[model samples]
Target: MHMMLMADEKRLCKRFFHFRIAACARAHLLRRSVCAGFLTFLIAAVFCLSLFSAAPVKADDKVLRVLAWPGYADADVVNHFEARYKARVEVTLVDSDEALWAQMHAKGTPPFDVLAANTAEIQRYTEANLLAPLDLARLPNTRKQLPRFQALASIGGLTSGGKAYAIPFTYSSMGLIYDRKQVAVAPRTMRELWNPRYRGKVLDFNSAQHNFSFTALALGYPHPFQLDPTEMRTIAHKLVDLRRNLLTYYTLPEEATAFFIQHKVALMFGNYGTQQVELLRRAGADVGYVIPDEGALAWLDCWSMTRAAADPPLALAWINYMLEPDVSALLTQRQGLANTLTAPVESSDSARIVWIGPVENIQRREDLWARIVSGDRSERF
Candidate 1:
């Protein structure tokens, strides 16, 4: 009976050991399943977080659309302005006054918030009610400008109906550029353009308004911009005479430079003034620039706000920024343009700078100029 009882106890111990082992296996399987589910959940969470991070953020809404000349709004300059104002700048570059006019009048409200134009164009814009009156109070940098620019009333086309519409930014005198090797002495007057000795070696700007004005100056007309019908006909004949002396009429500074180098041009009307001089010098042309004794036609480019500015304050800020010393100096350094903040070294005190004004009749001049360019005879005038 004792042996049987001991065997029973051993069997009971073996059964308990088996049961414990099964329970341990079940627990281990449950732990692995829980770990696998947890791992899947963590990966999904990481992927979701990455997707959220990869989403694009909205861009800045403050955009300043600018219409300017080639060197006026350079990439670096525009970038600096954008960073300072925390806004994006869209720059549109126009090469000619006609192109600028087309861009300004293309849309009903003038797509640009602000633009750079010469004083004559400023007057045209004012007459058309395309510009807004500038608030002097907003542009504190005007105090830093030279005395000439400070006297806004003295500058033609800046003010209309007692309201100031523009601020002077840069200026250049239309003078004469001659090759040092070809010409011994600098040309003293605009009459040198028609010198018979330099025929087929002279280059002129292909513009109606400027050609008429300078021809009037050459003829000793008191007011070049206010020519009468008789004066216009006389000047047109004079230009026809000039056309005989021309190698070709150039519209851009670079084109003129190429012509000077390639064609061995002896004389040229420096339409871009010192800016062209800089370009020619950089191109290794030994050229001399001189303002004629009669007086050189000058264009004072200014900044003006459009009548349909989306943000007036922002537009005013751009104008004010342009007047800053650094910005103004950059214009001179890069473009060779004379800024209003400082006096130009290239200009002489004795040089007469005739600022451009509204012309007598633009359409008439354009019509005559087109005919002249097409080889019209002097008798047609």
Candidate 2:
């Protein structure tokens, strides 16, 4: 009986060992299956996430192309507009009116939706049928502008056949900027630019229209823009003489400030007016701005839409956005330009501000100015 019990125990032990081995094998297979399933899921999830990441958030997103001067469409300002409108703004800055004109007329280039130009240029653009007349009703913010700006017809070059073309944004007199240390007293007249004492120490704007206009003002011409052939010839010679005194001709205000500091320049033709003064003072220079006795040429830059605007509503929105008090105030606070909404802190009460008018002949002035800039002799004029 004891032998029989021993055999039974041995059999039971072998059977228990076999059962345990089978259980262990089953557990191992279950874990492997779970892990493989998890790996497949993870890979598929990652692929889907990458596809979503690569696609555009909005397939029908709009883009606004703007052509303007520096400080007109600053990055921060544009970013605000983009966020508010849910659109992309591409800003192209031009330093001079000539550069602006060239960009507007460039062949094979993508057209701009809106642009900033002086009233005179607005007239030029209108006559060429390059600009579309604005619907003032669409621009509600224009109501916030001063009475002078609201009455567009009262302002020259902004209307044609009783239809307004542009809305005024900012204005500044093309005054004179002088280093306070070098110029003991404020310059009394534009003639000071030609003074022998400041020769090789003066800086001038590299603009043909303005150069001729201001020189005509200094020479006491009844109509600077309406100069006859003889007056044009005389003004051209005067510009040649003025060129002899220039340290250099500058297109942008920042470039003028750089030259002023690096070379210790004494005087500059402030094409940008108080904007240059603000820039110079910020750069740690003691400078003063003055509108000469003959009166300073001023510009009233306005916003206008192009004839080829892809979206007229979007273009009008941009124009209206510019006149917003906050946006217009930024023009005054950051750029030292006077906005149409508020009174400027920088006073021009002392000097006359001659708003620029359309020239007698744009091509003639351009041609003469080109030769003058290229060092043409006085006799050639």
Candidate 3:
């Protein structure tokens, strides 16, 4: 039977090639070179089709659809994964959490197979029943991560009802960034952004969640995420102070890097932490990164499979592949963020990182943040 199929394919290719050559010769209106090239392409296609006709193609072809923040699934990274699994990988980058949420919830079911999101964002997806229950047994690489992340159930948003929903991948703090040439020494605390000397020379993140939480931290609010009414007012006043002493607020890392160089920005709220530092340094700026004495807010981005995923085992394989040392090392080499596979020297275990959570009132904070940015007086609060 196999010999008969091969003979049929060979005969079909011969007939197809002869027809193409005759057709090319009849095309007197076309350039001779162009017609010859087209004929050659047809012949090659026929030959290749005949060679691969016996192979059965899998329905999925192990297509791994990934949705993550910029730098998480870069071209080189995706290419490596694709080569290893002999699979097709599609990566979608989202700049903001809201954009991620919008993309995931665009239809009834999320389009992505696996998504990298923060703990808070994961909670939203879980509540909406958009995430799938993870099979940790398939993800043996999770065991190779740091001991702190080994207990997924103890983590606030990772595990629910005895089922693990996500696995930790990378994390970083919203530290302070200062131009070394402008500032002789590293800024020890986040409060330096409020220093009067650097007034009109400082930049801040343009998000309410970060603005409010960091201000609450600087104001010594015991609970930054769940601030009391009085704490809210005080934090608002402090935020107004931050606004008064700023050049402008920026949202994207690329924008911040450009503005820092063009404006000679002295200090900035490093919302993207080491990621921004890498961008600035690459742009030929001398800078220093410091996690303030008062502690900096941090985010842990994890990988979770979407409920709409077509192939569960393939999704798990991608997660396990990412947890590999070489792949995780790319996080630091390419993006300058800390991966969870191993602990780094700069990120001490004792360092204080106020993990982000659902805020007491995101809407109220956003409204107040707008007022503050518009030059509302402290007494107005």
Winner by lDDT between candidate 2 and candidate 1: 2
Sorted by lDDT (best first), the order is 2, 1, 3
What overall lDDT goes with each candidate model? 0.86, 0.87, 0.82
Candidate 3: where is the Cα deviation over 4 Å?
Answer: 1-62, 107-110, 370-381
Checking candidate 3 for backbone clashes, the offending pairs are: none
Which 10-residue span in candidate 3 carries the lowest summed lDDT? 21-30
Residue range with the least summed lDDT across 10 consecutive positions in model 1: 17-26
Query: What are the candidates' C-alpha RMSDs?
Result: 31.5, 28.7, 20.2
Candidate 2's C-alpha runs over 4 A off are: 1-59
Identify the candidate with maximal TM-score.
2
- What ranking of all candidate models by TM-score puts the best one first? 2, 1, 3
TM-score of 3: 0.78
Question: If candidate 2 were superposed on the true structure by all CA atoms, what would the RMSD be?
Answer: 28.7
Model 1 residue 288 CA deviation (Å) reads 0.9
